[model samples]
Target: ILSAVDTFGFHLNALDLRQNSESFEAVLDELFAAAGVTAPDAGYASLDESAKRELLVAELTSARPLVFPWSQDFSADTERELGIFRAAAQAVELLGPGVVPHCIVSMTGTVSDILEPMVLLKEVGIISFNPAQQRLVGSVDIAPLFETIEDLKAGAEILQELWEVDLYRGYLRGREDVQEVVLGYSDSNKDGGYLSANWALYDAQLAIVKACDTHGIGLRFSHGRGGAVGRGGGPTYDAILAQPEGAVRGSVRITEQGEVISARYGTASTARRHLEAFVAGTLEASLLDTESLKEPERAYGIMRDIASLAGEKYAQLVRDDSGFIDYFTQSTPLHEIGDLNMGSRPTARKQTESIGDLRAIPWVLSWSQSRVNLPGWFGVGTGIMRWAGEDETRWQDLRKLYQAWPFFRSVLDNMAQVMGKASMNLAQIYSTLVDDPTVSQRVFNTILDEYELTKEVFFRITGHDSLMAGNERLERSVQRRYPYLLPLNAIQIELLRRYRAGEDTFLVSKTIQVTMNGLATGLRTSG
Candidate 1:
């Protein structure tokens, strides 16, 4: 806490309290009932976006409080959430502005989702309209986190709608016309694949930029990146530079979690290096027009094609294949990983076979443990192959694009690093753990085929015969780690075999857990 205060002053790190938008709606429903008044237009949930916006605008524009201390009748969860907002209001009075700068609503799909939190903030006295001044007063920014691919695609439309409302437009003026939107890297990647996720995010940002421009709003993007490629992890500097033009817009935020936090900030010198890289990258992205060389429309079209083809291929293997779940459970240390307790967040959103329920960290970590790193490179090869085919000209165009486009270059480079670290032989060994030989062979063969194709495509684009060819230092460093990783992989496979064969003992489970940690450390990635 002291360190945070020292670095960021009394406001500290500016906590962003997040919850599902539905939860906020439920809270508002209870609040309405407790106040003994019908909602402005029926119940909050039943109201359409236009009604909700109109109601919210009326409430925010009034000086009257929605809920008072005497009327604080609500369920335990609702009360707790309200108490948090009330505390935040108090904190602003005590610690000054910036203590809690944002209340992020996750799974935000509609204008109502954004307005729901704003109403709660008004109830807590964090936001109010001044009739004399004709403006809203508030310190916290209510950011909507768009997670799934569908949400990302619709992000611009949602923001545009929010800005169109006269009341919300006035509120934006109070915020100096600045709006923050969070894009979820992990969820989208899990929903689609790496290529589709990247393309969706890029297109979303482009559309959002245009929307913000049209509304005369300053846009700030918060990237929900994780410590794996599937979760938008890569060299921080390159990643920032690779963002869609105007996406950075002088300010940006990204989540650094798990091993990434430690790896970047564990030491003073390392932290300095990482911070310097971030600052430099941000400045370059904000000031420089990196998209001049490539035609934006042309690039977008190519990426769209690639993402569509790649996403389909990825869905075929992971989603369409019924035996994939069994293969994943057997081939990787997913079950053991849960017991490792590496994080406070639940491994799965719910108990289900659906990939959407599984968090991205474990998704990529599982693949990393098996030495396949499938999440990073799976559908990319197929996508490239389908696009290029036997056309030498198309292949040449890709190489030129890789050279000129920061986004394309970064994607290929990151994939190369992940692919270089993968061990097909080790991956094959893990495939044996699958119960049925036919299923195992079928999936494994597909993976192997894709892996080979990915390598071929990567080399073709990079003009290199081998992975990490130009960066010998990094290549050597990764190569050195591979031999050490083999023992842990071997141990993990044996332990998985024993444990799955009904030897589910404490020691066996513990060993498998330890091996998982070792592999993640050695690989410098977590799912």
Candidate 2:
């Protein structure tokens, strides 16, 4: 029974020499020693000596895989150098014998120079291109950014050239090599519009998959998905099932982000259920019906175009709006979130006073706290409503897409859940935080109007009045806990007002933590 189940695993972080004084490699080695390699059911272990090796040779040979996260934009400082080396060394040692190492490339800081160095470290196996970096680039014309057929082909060509050359060949330090790349949805969509990021990623993955197939190299894709739809949320089963046939043929990995980690695996039973779901979903997707694959490519293209147009509109409203940032800061308790100090990383990369620099976590957190959850459904509601505006043909196509494509359907279902929990009226209570009535009215009204339209569309599509329609337990749970959570929001706002007034840390830290705990408990996910 244990062997029948796929065990759960957490992605580990290597202590970069720059980030830590302690040896991260040593720490990991210790973890491996205790945790054992290849999980018990798989019986994968990293044996140190001949006797131990002989004892386990029959049970395990290949090491469990390792996933590495690297910052592409790190400063050219001692720490950055050390971090890169530390991560690389760890992967070289830990990966193989059941370990697969992956590198996450942050597209923000030093992207132009990042790829060249990566070609030298081909043995590291997986390298990801994060579109979230475009958010930090502050580039106005972001349309030419999607990874294209030409781009993937070019990258592959570059790899082939490097493999034949001395510079990259010498740097690899003698190991067989293959590379995998990942695309991020959270940071990318948060920087770009939701639809834009989604399309860019879809296009990129499809391009890469084809490129690998043409080149006769194994291709693996890891999706950097967050907890909500706006941040790349979708149903795991359907999402995997809808993959472009061979795109996810053999292996895959995705970040289990905020709330999702707790929601899916807070307990052992839930963990088992979720793990089984992934295995089941992946297996099912690997065997999709031929009819779905036979659907005309033009049909898919039309949906992509509609999504792109809607994304453009979404970008206009959020990124282009002049005063929306001010309204975002004032209306939401975002200021306090920084004071909360919940995670290991900073909310923003620099200490600048702009929302553009803020990380996706806090951005999502702010809207969640305000009960607007603007990130999840902001542009989507408008896009969908407008999509329904043009003609019955488009609407019919969209409805059909929603019904036929598991990916599209999963997106809608996620939004439906997010929208149901969202309370624009409750969000309005915090509107006094904003001084500009026009900006407030526009932001607030736009969200409220879109919510009604979204709910209507959702009802029409699902033939259900509201989300969780048949699940009374979930609805009742939300109802009972909402009142408790509202007070936390109120307290969070008051604390933020005091902190901003130049008061000491006494109130802000305590009150913020209080609210964090309460919300984390009440909502079952932190705001």
Candidate 3:
């Protein structure tokens, strides 16, 4: 029985329901209108941040349900949103609190953003507020996901402001005075580069830990990591061990989705290994058992400088270059991915061609499929090189930093793992798919140059003879898989060319999809 219990998690992974904050705002807008609540210009969605916070708290203070779900007609979107919450509430009532434990607010930017979902959930009775008793009771946790680089930088400040709200504080007290903060890895990676995103997350954790400590609140970090390095995928043990001290607090939740779920936990042995990693990582992180640098402040300053310079370089290609979108869409299988019935989720949030609108899964997956792995290492070379410059002392400092700082080392090592798997030769072949010679040549050349620079700087800093030098497990994994992956990539390229040139046939599309699934399985972090 004990062995069976260990092998099987009976609803061990709690369902975490998530949606964009805008979805909550829209639902509230419809609900307010239905309830005949009078407000200024735009009802609920148009209120300023402060007003939204106060109004939401006041609404919570009233102990009244905002919606007459049976009586009022709601927009399809609103109904859909309400339907999900209602279903979740019903499930919790029937199956107990373990059925759906969290309602996460994605793209959460403000105090109001965090409160919005709580308000909606209150209307459905998932949470209750007693105005007369000044009490709040919640059946589920409300976790705010901070995704963008800007949002990550402001997370601590937002939390500080949030905890000041008496009602929110009261709600926290009801939930054991704990706050679960989700750090978004994919969006932050796409917004900046690998180095910048990693640094931002680490720095934000340092600040947030301090803030939570000041408030005497228990803090739990739920990492919104994907299966790819660009999406916060790496060696789980190392990644957790590298976190800022006190960030873990013996409780950390790392998301596992798509290929990662299979890659990490497909088999019994692999599953046990990863579970051990999580347990070990938490214990080590909580105990302050990891190594620490003597000059943390100095290392922090150096990292900030590197990340700033690197971010500019990343923006130069991904954000500033107008031709980049065309280059990316043309070269990679991004559009074709949209055609595949991967799941119920769309490839993008909107039909528009904005990078921000493109979900991070597809963005990173596209790059991964093409084998450029651009999101993993782009701009890092420029960041490190430009910051170090011609100063030999600075170069030595970086090498020492990599040796001493767990966070910095993890950043470089993970990049090495991704870069080791990436083949510029294969990427160059994919570049031929681009129509415009100028765009293809310019972008490819820039990528190759950075690849060379990044590899050089990576080896120099780590004092490793080759990429994946110390990581024999990854090296062996790559060696075994590369032979199989290369041919699939080549075939995929030809198939893409044929299909794009109007071959539009069942066989052609089918073959292309076969190669896609094959690569995704082999890459493990493909999507």
Candidate 4:
């Protein structure tokens, strides 16, 4: 227990206080209003980008904070948020900087979004600017989480614009010129599908690196990965090594979600192994010149073609086909999974039927429970087949690329692992939960056909006749666990059947929840 406590820290890992950028802006607007400032009379949201930046810089650089003893007129939500930041400051002061190292602004689109948190931190005395000393004082890193494909594509420009601000530049100088930007894997995947998400993340990192280089600043990336292949889940070592050149200069941060945390760190030995792999991978990525492994120009073209084709196919099934959602919710134990008290975080970002609004954890977890594992490899086969069919030479080129490029190889290998875990026979069983036979048959058939194609392409590319051919230990482990998972899957299907058929008993719900947890454990993955 002491070992566990020590490993997890006083707070069970460094806490990062995060909120949408718009929330921070709202907090600031309240502060400005209480102070009787007319500059924001039209509201901060309506202000143009340049005007917002100017106001933010003025407020952040001022020795006087926006908050005062008389600033008690703010809304309850704003007060709670401010209190959270204040608590973070106090925590840092009491427990040292590691207690809360980051104040992340999610969905950060503009330069002002990055500055809004800094302004809030200054109000709580976590950050201060002294023009006389020509330096800035701060303990926490303000990280911008670029989540959408568009935000990712525009990441470098936003960072460059933020750095050009004199006050922010001073903060960077104080922090040793290192800036940490978080690339959100889950949201981007949800927004643009797997292929598009991967490519956008890579391209964003490359651009951000270039921007940092031009500005003579060191860059660090925080990867927001989940346990499923759809959410940037894969072998961590290979994933790190496959990063674009200069992306992982010396440091990297990744989020191991609750489900993955248990699987990877449930025991001392397992925890140690995972940590060692992370350190080893980071060291190798930092020191090795992986750029020489492949011709990047040629590789980039192939990847673009693959991502385009894959993204279109993914959208056709998930977004274009209206019946897919019904198939997904009915076939998987998604609703029951939400009722499980797995974590403090809410299951969905907002209450909505749209897949885009569904958080990635549940999105991937539901698929894992159903044994379809669609997020990991759904669109990949179509992408490969389309690319290869356009030109016969492309197939040979892909084989050569897989052999030569660690990035390409890692992508296919990770997909193969998820594909290996997928049991179509069991997936067929789950499909029975779908009320309409036509919808179930159509969607399941599409998924099954794609699964076969993915497996075939994956084997051909890797030159392996069987999945996990090189990893005997993993194969053996899977075989041993395979039988145990079948019972849980069977129980889940029955429970789902009864529950959907209007047998909405608490006992039935609880049993379904238990089975969901069991399957997630058996598979060593959740959302």
Candidate 5:
């Protein structure tokens, strides 16, 4: 629907499972409605083979590229879902007039063993890769996890094994049918926790780059990132530039997710600006690869170590601490997320009360509400602060990283937004969920002090008051959203109290669902 001749674009490619029997004309009518070409549809879109083909034909005639839905993994039983995606791609290929079909692959956690990446390429016949490694580790500590160096070595072994099985090994090395490989970050980061996830991702990308270089593969990495930095959301321009040299070769693709899509692409001017940032960021990264920007190996190692320690502390708080899970579930509106019906994906994999079973949206959302925002910046400040105090060279490397690497810079930028939104005073309003006042106070005070110290360190490094510079619109938007959030928070608190006071189970469930709906609508993003 975005018609500007900018470096960005989007198209709606609906695959309806609820009503796959609808007629072609009826579906075309629906696309018209969803795209706002006609009016908003009174009903959701339907999925019919003929209808999908017709839509694809129409889109192709307009020179628009269509992204096929491949959200379901290989084991999906919804034959309709599987059939529609495969059929659409085949139609695109057979028509083959001028349109290029985009393929996507996602892994579901049900697989007892790791999935072979090449299976996706063989089955789909087109490569659109986004692996969900982070979600795989359900009950394990992911941070400081690789501190023994053996972890990295073992990871390398996995990389070698994957290289043997992946189509990229053949294609990047001059085999056929391999056009691109997309790397995922958000889900993986959530699974690995912050410190481990970030490092793991960096290592993975670096390894891929090495593989491509060694084999002469023309690889285009499409980053599956999200709206918040904790979910791999950050300043796009800076993040792209931070790529290890030779990793990015002008071509880049990243997901515009959740609240960020509306914030950046909601309007004409803002959308155009967003496109410009991508083009600008890609160019800057491509042009600038110099010695001054490189982190000394020793300094980088120290930063990694501090990050590992910090991540361990963070993981211990969330995963190992007793009653923290109860506090999380009872203190926030997370229980209601499953019933909210906001996203295409379920909130949990199965019926379970564990944090590992909880979806990342509600996980990040709860922390965001309590104002702890553990995902955005839990270990970072302590990691950096500790490193700076101990070694001057390490501190210098941190500064260079902020200035040079797009990834580190984006991390800091996201932290600033989190700080602006989070308030310890307001968080105290929600902390009353914990019956133990001493524990509540201890946790709250520790988080708040760390947040402040982190902000000071960030300011010292970036010399900025906040993330958005000269962006009054964003500031105003956050302010407006904050007031709206307060009502949802109060509702959640009341609902929780009643539920605990022996309220009817059904009523409690409905209340939780309603609270989720209101909060998601108000925030405009799940987290």
Candidate 6:
């Protein structure tokens, strides 16, 4: 029933080719130099954005490939980069489109960022420019990954511009004009605080959906989620239902990392249940009007203000506080987390003191290990308090929003769960590790005050005396987990002191690791 041209596998595999935009630029710089397209002194990366865009577009339309598979002129990094796409091409040619679905470029802020991967795919034979028709022949899709808060805000506009490019439009025709967008939660959360990042993501989805509708393009969103609420972790079912209307569109892809994958899908029965929940949630969200708010625009405006206030306060902590880094690195086992090598990527992009460079996983893990869990709920209280200052009507309106708006309810509830797991007591215990007592006490005191304020505001808005009041099962689980966490956290702190104070024995190191494992296990979904 199938011809050679039409036949394709349902899916052999669909692993996305993900790399930072900087890496793409580096590889291009080398390729342009090797090909004599640029002056030896002035490489591709040295060019301005406009010049780079013009060159990349021109390169995509050119008949000749940039890299010659047999050439040894390319730097080691360039060769390895080319080799990856080359292997992807081989897999796709052999297996089908399923082999390499999309090449996800991280930190994509411009049209050229999306085009860089297309050019690379061209060099590797994954794509070929057909001069006769002036179109591109390719099976792979170039998905732009918008990670930071600024990027998310600009994502829809970038996609709109990308679609307007003549060459890119032709390329999209091959894939039936479908575009995949990858949204990064961790960096967005890191850039803004919890409330701000969550709202931005939801708003970005809405904008992207509107843009796609206008362009008549099919869209699929791949969520770069992590295991902590700070990193977009929460109940899968609730998260799905909370998606802005038209966000799901019958297809969704969410990532699970670290212990989360095993916890969610380790056993056959649990896997089936989670699979069922995912399917049920996706279907319900796609078919039904999940976003039920009496005044959608009004709620949106309020949330925007709160997010702005929260972001400002969050900056006061991570960005403004001089002692924050010392408070973070010294108080928690961040250095030790690097040793775990929990994932393919490093804990930070490179050695840097700036919080922006540090990867979200370890940023969250350090906080979780210290029992601070700051990422999940910090700055929200002050934001909410400032907005509803001495106003009972405003507080009542928020309560109504929590009851009626699934998105609002989901956010507040998830934050509540993460906050409930946090321990001020244990956080103080870990604070003792800080070298400067003054820094330790000041930072810890600030955390303590914010913690109380956040809890107070959260309870008032939800009309609940405690966290996860609606979820008896989770509440019971947390209650069960806390006892084990106390002793494990205490032991880990002790071991950490010995480990840091020149007790370099394998016994101390291994025991510390064991404590980390125990803490991570007890506080399920922790970073």
Specify the highest-lDDT model's number: 6
lDDT of all predictions: 0.86, 0.56, 0.87, 0.85, 0.55, 0.88
Query: Candidate 1: lDDT of 34?
Result: 68
What digit string (tens of lDDT, one per residue) describes model 2 on residues 236-255?
76667756666676567666
Model 5: which ten-residue window has the lowest total lDDT? 135-144
Pairs with steric clashes in candidate 1: 361-527, 362-527, 365-527
TM-score against truth, every candidate: 0.93, 0.72, 0.96, 0.93, 0.69, 0.96
Off by over 4 Å in 6: 1-12, 69-72
User: Model 3, range 177-276, lDDT digits (tens) per residue?
Assistant: 8999999999999889888999999999989999999889999999989889999998899999999888988789988888778778889999999999
State the lDDT of candidate 6 residue by residue for 1-527, as single tens digits: 35633554645347789899989989988888888789999999889878988998899888776666575577788878988988898888877767787899999988888888888898878888988999998888888999999999999999999888888989998888889999999999998989989989998998999999999999888899998899999889999999988889898999877777898899999999999999999999899998888778899999999998999989998889999989999999888877773667787887758789798988898898898999999999999999999999999999998888899999899999998888898899999999999999999999999999999998888878888797889999899878777888889899899889999798988888888778878887555
Tens digit of lDDT per residue, candidate 1, span 394-498?
888888889888998888888888888899999999999999999999999999999999899898888898888867998988889878888999999998999
What's model 4's lDDT at 471? 74
**What is the C-alpha local distance difference test score of candidate 2?**
0.56
TM-score of candidate 4 relative to the true fold: 0.93
Per-residue lDDT for 178 in model 5? 31
Error of 2 at 286 (Å): 1.7
Number of backbone collisions per candidate: 3, 13, 0, 0, 6, 0
**How does residue 258 of candidate 2 score in lDDT?**
70
Model 5 ranges off by over 4 Å:
1-159, 163-179, 290-296, 351-354, 390-397, 435-442, 460-488, 499-527
